[model samples]
Target: MTETLTTALIEMREDDVLAAVRAATEAGTSPAGIIAGLQAGMKTIGDKYEAGEYFLSELIMSAEIFKRALAELGLDQSAAGTGTRGTVILGTVHTDIHDIGKNIVASVLSANGFKVVDLGVDVPAQRFLDAARENDARVIGLSCLLTTAFPAMRETIATFAAAGLRDQVSIIIGGGPVNADLALQLGADGAGISAQEAVILAAKAVEGGVA
Candidate 1:
């Protein structure tokens, strides 16, 4: 890992990290190495969140900064399946436009080398199914910030089952209004309480395992 880049990223200095990524890419840094640095940065942010030193706004800002820098690193989206890591389809459930948490999870997964297909906000159940099917994603990440969107989460799972894709994709739910109990009630495979937990659980879910 690039220690300097990782350290600067932990400090949440977007410009510094971007410079490091650019320099590394130009200097022949391997894609895996650059991704490791990004993942380290995400882990730092996750630590801050767990320590109550970072808020949702901070998390979202950091995610966007990393995504922009990663894009500059020449990551091949078309080669998403080239890595040993499995694919993930992430989205903010239908009617839920709050995507801060969802974006954090997606960024973390991306840094960890998981091919993430982010469906963005207000993603309907059918869209999730379509993305999962199209990408052959191993896991489906659902984020909800409102209790009203809770039904959308359940509907998504139902749609997957109806399409005979439920067993093929593990469902993970997260965000402010979500909890382990609700996740279980909704028939989800797992629930993530924080960005760190999301990364851990997502990796496991993709492997057809859980934490």
Candidate 2:
């Protein structure tokens, strides 16, 4: 049981999480090991969300605490393309300011060696295009927490199509309100049901392996 940091993250105990992180570091826990514990906690948080034991607020609180803990441990979230696996352009879609799920995915992806270009919340469709061009990202990840952002997702995919990069770029949609149906409907490469799942999707998308 990785409950030392896992439980603190699950319980959203900011102080306890930091304390446990420090304790683990002093006890010779590798950085990857520490991050894995936090990631495990996030997986449990995601499971609770799916099981209806946790709501959006709990997700939000847990994400904030998780992010803070990462920063406390000197894990830079903004250090994009710093991984060997691949690069993933990630962000919350337009009109979806709630980034509880996005934050979790970002942390997990980074820990798993995915270079993440996180564009943050309330991102416009064109921003994705610009970021993709600037970063030359092959895997584009769109996260939607609001149902209203569905249209925005459509527009984003259309933007890629309009630019003739749809075939070259693999788009992945995720977040609380997203599911496989929505992912297919939006013509996304796939739906990321979890953070680890997103990593797999990104790794595949990079090589143009997404269907």
Candidate 3:
């Protein structure tokens, strides 16, 4: 886990957990060990945010650092054949450039050994479907920060259903404007308040079996 983190951190140097992942992986740490470290770090960051010790800008910076570290580790390939890891398609809905939460979720999922295919911000419903098809992802995560873009989230899920892929993957959603009730209404499998919580929800979705 430590090794996984080291590699992940190296790839996602800008984000908090990803860089830590690289540091831990380089030391030959196990995947589980790396995840534990990331969970701790994410919790710390969340606590800081709750206490007003940090702001959205700081959170965004941290997420960037984590993202770079994950890229450095080539986590997409490393996650394969790892029993606890699985592939996920993640994106922020169209017309919304805010990706702080999406980026954080991607980093945490990557650190936890999940292969995350992040479709960056302002992603269209078609692109989300394309990514899911390309990756054969079992999980689909949507992030929407703007209230106006909220409908895009549902459209993405509906697109999956239209393509006959909805039942094949578990859809999870979050971000500034997302709520559990809304997500459920949109047909998502679950919702999370933070990226760490998203990772946990994704894991549960995976464990319960996608589909």
Candidate 4:
């Protein structure tokens, strides 16, 4: 972790984190290195959220802060498409309008060399499948903030299988109310508890396609 940036991010100091990111970028720090630091910070923040030390508001605010840091570095999703390692289709599951986590995943993935097709929030299963098909994406990320959206995730996976693309593309799930067991139960490739882990999962999923 970029110690300064991670500390500022853990404390939710937006200005300080941005300053650190800028300083690091100017010092020729690789975007991947900088993102690793931010990712560590995000993991800690997520831990706090899971421990009940942080509320939904803090979790949302932290994601917003991270998004801004990415934008400051020009490595946000806008810069994620050039010379991509692989394509990933990402979105909030149907009936789930929350997008904080999904946005963070997109930013992180983009900064880490992935091309992300973000489908935004409340996206249907067919939309996810269609985007994956259209982009030839090898990895799909599903984010859900509400229990109500769980069914949609299940349906999304089922839709992929029904389309005969289940074995073709890897699917990963994340966000509140989702866990590793739930991911297995849904028959997904994996579950990401944090943005950094999501990157790892996506990369591995793409590697699976390559192999």
Best by TM-score: 1
lDDT of 2 at 101: 80
- Number of the top-ranking candidate, with lDDT as the measure: 4
Q: lDDT for model 1, on a 0 to 1 scale?
A: 0.80
Per-residue lDDT of candidate 4, residues 1-211 (tens digit): 3899999988989999999999998899988788778767867876676577876565556667777888887866446333267888999989999998888778667645678899999999999999988998889999999988989999999999999999898899999788999998989889998776787788788775621
| Ranking of candidates on lDDT, top first | 4, 1, 2, 3
Total clashing pairs in model 4: 0
Q: Cα RMSD (Å) per model?
A: 3.3, 4.8, 6.1, 5.1
Error of 2 at 3 (Å): 20
**What is candidate 1's lDDT per residue for 97-150, written digit by digit as tens?**
999788777766765557888999999999999999898887889999999999
Error of 4 at 38 (Å): 13
Global Cα lDDT for candidate 4: 0.82
Candidate scoring better on lDDT of 2 and 3:
2
Clashes of each: 0, 0, 41, 0
Which model, 3 or 4, shows the larger TM-score?
A: 3
Cα lDDT for residue 24, model 2?
Answer: 89
Cα lDDT for residue 205, candidate 2:
74
Where does model 4 exceed 4 Å of error? 1-83
Deviation (Å) of 188 in candidate 4: 0.9
- Residue 91, model 4: Cα distance from true site in angstroms: 0.5
Residue 24 lDDT (model 1): 85
Candidate 2: regions farther than 4 A off: 1-82
Output the lDDT of residue 141, model 3: 89
Residues 114-167, candidate 2: write the lDDT tens digits. 778899998999999999999888889999877899999999999999999998
